[model samples]
Target: MEKSRVYFTDMRTTENSNLQKKLARLIRKAGIGNIDFEKKYVAIKIHFGEPGNLSYLRPNYAKTVADTVKDLDGKPFLTDCNTLYVGGRKNALDHIDTAYLNGFSPFSTGCHVIIADGLKGTDEVLVPVSGGKYVKEAKIGRAVMDADVFISLTHFKGHEITGFGGALKNIGMGCGSRAGKMEMHSAGKPYVIQEQCVGCRVCAKSCAHDAISFTDKKANINHSLCAGCGRCIGVCHRDAIKPADDESFDILNQKVAEYTKAVVDKRPCFHISLVVDVSPQCDCHSGNDAAIVPDVGMFASFDPVALDVACADAVNAQPPIQNSQLKEHWNESGDHFHKVGPNTNWKVGIAHAVELGIGTTEYELIRV
Candidate 1:
C-alpha cells in the first residue's frame, strides 16, 4: 500500500503564533489548497457538541477552517446530521439552536450552519456504495451529498460504541441520516426504556408508524408496528429510547467505513482531526468526562483512514493523564481507546476502510 501523508503540528505555541494559525498552515501544507474550491459548495462536516458536552471542538477552530476555504473561493458551510439519540441536536431547528448555544454562529465561524438531515431527519439521499460489503445503499444527508466538495472537521475522542471517534466516525456515522443511523446501529429496531421514560409522549409524536403507546405514564414501542426510522430516539428528552447496539463491534465498524465510502466517493474531500481533550466517550453525550490522555496535536490528511490511524497511534504513544478515567486500566493492552471502552475495537473500522479503498492505514507522518 502506498503511504498517505498525514500532516501534524504540536499544540505548543508562542504569543507570536497560535493554534488557529498553525491549523491553517498544517492544512495548506497537507494540500487542502490543491482542491479547486472556486464557487463550489463545500460541506465541512463537524459535530456541534451535544448541549452539555464541553469537549467538542471549539467554533474558533471551525472558523479557521471555514476561512481557509473561503480564501480559496469555496462557499463553505459547517454541517452535521441530526443524531439518532435524543439530545439538543435532534431536529434541524433544535440542532441549529444548539449550535448557536455552543457559539457556532455565522458571526463566530464565518459560515452558516446547515443541519444536513432536514427538519425530521428524513431529508436524505440514497447513495450507492460501490464496494460496500455491509451497506449497498448508504442514506446520507442530502445537503452533505449535494456538496461539490466534502471536508471532515472532527474532534478526536473516545466512544462507548466505536472505541474512538475520528475522521471516519465524523463522516460515516455523523453524516448518516436518522434512518441511515438505524441501519448502521442494528439489523433490527429501536425500543423504549420504560424506566427512563417520562411518558411526555414526545417519542409518540415523532414516530410516524404509530408504534408507541402510553400506559401508566410510560411509553412502549410495538416492534411489529415500528418502522425503525429512529425519530423517536431523537425526540425523547429523557434518553428513554435507543437503537439496538446488537451488532458486533467489528460489524458496526465495517458499516461505518462503508457509510464513509458512500459520502466521499468521487468528491474532493479533506479531513482534519484535533486530538485534544481525549475524552473517554463520544461527544454525543450530554457531558464529557476527564481527559484520558494529554492533548496530542492537530492532524490533517486527504485520506480518512490514514488520518484516523495516525491519530490513534499518536494517542497510544502518549501516557495516560493521572487520575483520569484511563488510569483505571491504562495500557492493559497498550491501546487506550480499547481500554477505555473494552467492548470496542477501533482498528476494525480503519482496516475495513482500507479494504474499501477509502484510504491506506500506512501513512508517513509529516510535521509542518
Candidate 2:
C-alpha cells in the first residue's frame, strides 16, 4: 500500500504566527482545501468536553477551523452526538448547554453547534458497515450522516479502554448516536441497578420497548423486551440503569473502526488531531488527569487511520511527564498508549481499520 501523507506542526509559536495560525497553515499544507468545499454542508466533528474536563480543545481552535471552512466557501457546523452516559451531554438541550458552557457557542466558533442526535438521543440512522465482523450496521447520528463533507478535529490522548483516543475514536465513537455507542461499548442489554433506583419511573417512561417494571418502588428491566437503545440509562436521575460493559477491549476497538468507516465512507473526509493535554483517559469523565506527556505537535491527514498512527508515533517518541501515569509504566511497554492502558491495545483499531480498507497504517510524516 502506498503511504498516506501526514502533516505536522509543533507547538512553538513565533511572533508572527500564533498556534491558531500555525494550525491553519498546517491543515492547508496537508491539503484540506483540496476537497470541494464550495457551498457544501460540512460537519466538523469534535468533543465539546464534558463539563469540568479542562483538557479538551479550546473553542479558539474550533474558530480557526470554522473560519477556514468559511474561507473555502463551506457552510461549517461544529457537531457531536449526545453521549450514552448520564452526564451534562446526554440530550440535545444538555449537550448544547455544555458546549456553550465550555466555550463552543456560535459566537466563539463562528458556526452553529448541533447535537447530531435529536432530543432524546434516539434519532439515528443505521448504516451498514462494509466488511464488518462485529457490527453489521452502525447507528450513526442523523445529523452526522447528513453532512456533505466530514471533518474530525480530534484531541489525541490515552484512553483506559481504547489505549488511545485518536482520530479513529473521535470520528467513530464520537459520531455515534446513544444506541450506536451502546453497540460499540456493550455486548449485553442494560439492567437496573436495584440499589440506586428511586422508584421515579423515569426509566419506564423513556423505555419505548416496555423494558422497565417496578417492584417495591424499585425499577427492574426486562431484557427480553429491551432493544438496548440506552435511553433509560440517560434518563434515570439516580443513575439506576446501567449497560453491561462486557465487550472485550479489543473487540470494542474493532467496532469503533467499523463505525468510523460507516461515517466517513463515500464522503470527502479530513482529519486533524491535536496531541496536547495527553490525558490518561477519555474526556467523557467529568474531570481529566494530568498530562501523561508534554505537549506534542498538531497533525492532519486525509486518512483517519494513518493520522491516528502518526499521532501515536509522535506521542511515543516524547518523554513522559513526571507526575502522570505514563511515567510509572514507561519501562513496561515501548508504546506510550499501551503503557497507560494495558488491556486496550490502540493498535487493534488501527489494524482493523486497515483490514476494513478504511486507510493504510503506513504513512509519511511531513513536518510543516
Candidate 3:
C-alpha cells in the first residue's frame, strides 16, 4: 500500500505569520481545497474544552479553518456531540454554553457552535458501518450526519483510556450521540450516585425505557430495562449519573475507530491535528495536567489514520519533559502515550482503522 500524505508546520511564525495563519497554510497545502466546498454544509468537528481544561485547541485555529471554508463558498459550523460523561457538555444547551465559555462563540470562530446531538442527547441518526466489527450501526448525532462534508480539528494529546486522543478519537468518539458514546465506552448501563441524586426524578423523566426508579429519595437504574440511551446522564443537575467505563481499552479504541468510520463514510472529509498543549490526559478533563513533552507541530491529512500515526510518532520521538507525566511513567516501551497511559494500546485503533480501510498507517510527512 502507498503511504498517505500528512502535512506538517511548526508553531513558530514570522512577524507576518501567526499560528492561525500557518494553520491555514498547512491545511491548504495538505489538500483541503481539493474538496468541493462550494455551497456545502461542512461540519468542522472539534472539542470545545471542558469548562476548566486549558489544553484544548483555541478558537483561533478553528476560525482559520472556518474562514478558509467560507472563502471556498462553504457553510461551516463547529460541532461536537454531547459527551457520555456528566460534565458541562453532556447536553446541547449546557454544551453550547460551555463552548461559548471556552471561546468557541460564533464571533471567535467565524462560525456557529452546534451541539451535534440535540438538547437531551437523544437526537441521533443511525449510520451503518460498512466494514464494522465492533459497531454495526453507529448512532451519530443528527447534525453531524446531516453535514455534506466533515472535517476534524483535533487537539492531539494523551488520553487516560485510549492512550491518545487524535483524529480517530475526535471523529469517532466526538461524533457519536450519547447512546453511541455509551456503546463505545461500556457494555453496561449508567448507575446513579445515590448520594448525589436529589431524587428530583429528572433522570427518570428522561429515560425512554422507564429504566430509572427512585427509592428512599435516591435513583437507581434498571440495567435490564435500560437501553443505555444516556439521556439521564445529560439531564442530571447534580452530576449524579455516571456512565460505566468498563470496556477494555483495546475494545474502546477499536470501537472508536469504527464510530469514526461511520461518521466520515461517504463524506468529503479532511483532518487537522494540533499537537500543542501535549497534555497528559484528555481535554475532557476539567483540569489539564502538565505537558508530557514539548509541543510538536500541527499536522493535516486527508487520511485520519495516517494523521494519527504521524502525530503519535512525532510525540514518541520527542524527549519527555522533566517532571511531566511522561517522565514520571517512563518505560522501556519507548512509546510516549503508552508510557503515560500504560494500559492502553493506541495502535489498536490505528490497526483496526486500516483493516476497515479507513486509511493506511504508513505515511509520508510533507513539511509545509
The candidate maximizing lDDT is 1
Question: For every model shown, what is its TM-score relative to the native structure?
Answer: 0.90, 0.95, 0.94
Supply the TM-score for candidate 3.
0.94
Model 3 lDDT at residue 337: 86
Candidate 1 per-residue C-alpha lDDT over 1-368 given as tens digits, one digit per residue, 9 for 90 to 100: 88999999999999899999999999999999999999999999999999999999999999999999999999999999997766798889989999999999999999999999898687889999988998999989999999999999999999998999999999999999988998898978888787898779988887788999999999988999997677777556777788886788889889999999999998899999999999999998999899999999999999999999999999999888998888989654678887888889988888889889999988999998
Among all candidates shown, the one with the greatest TM-score: 2
Query: Model 2, range 1-368, lDDT digits (tens) per residue?
Result: 99999999999998888999999999999999999999999999999999999999999999999999999999999999988677999889989999999999999999999988888777889999999999888989999999999999999998999999999999899888888888898999988878888898988887899988889999888889998878787666776777788899999999999999999998899999999999999999999999999999899999999999999888988888998998888784588887788777888888999999999999999999
Candidate 1 lDDT trough over 10 residues, lowest sum: 228-237
How big is the positional error of residue 365 in model 3, measured in Å on the Cα after superposition? 1.0
What C-alpha RMSD separates each model from the true structure? 2.9, 1.8, 1.8
Candidate 1, position 82, lDDT: 90
lDDT of 2 at 102: 98
Lowest lDDT block of 10, candidate 2: 233-242
Q: What's the true lDDT of residue 61 in model 3? A: 92
Q: Which window of ten consecutive residues has the lowest lDDT sum in model 3?
A: 228-237
Clash pairs for candidate 2: none
TM-score result, candidate 2:
0.95
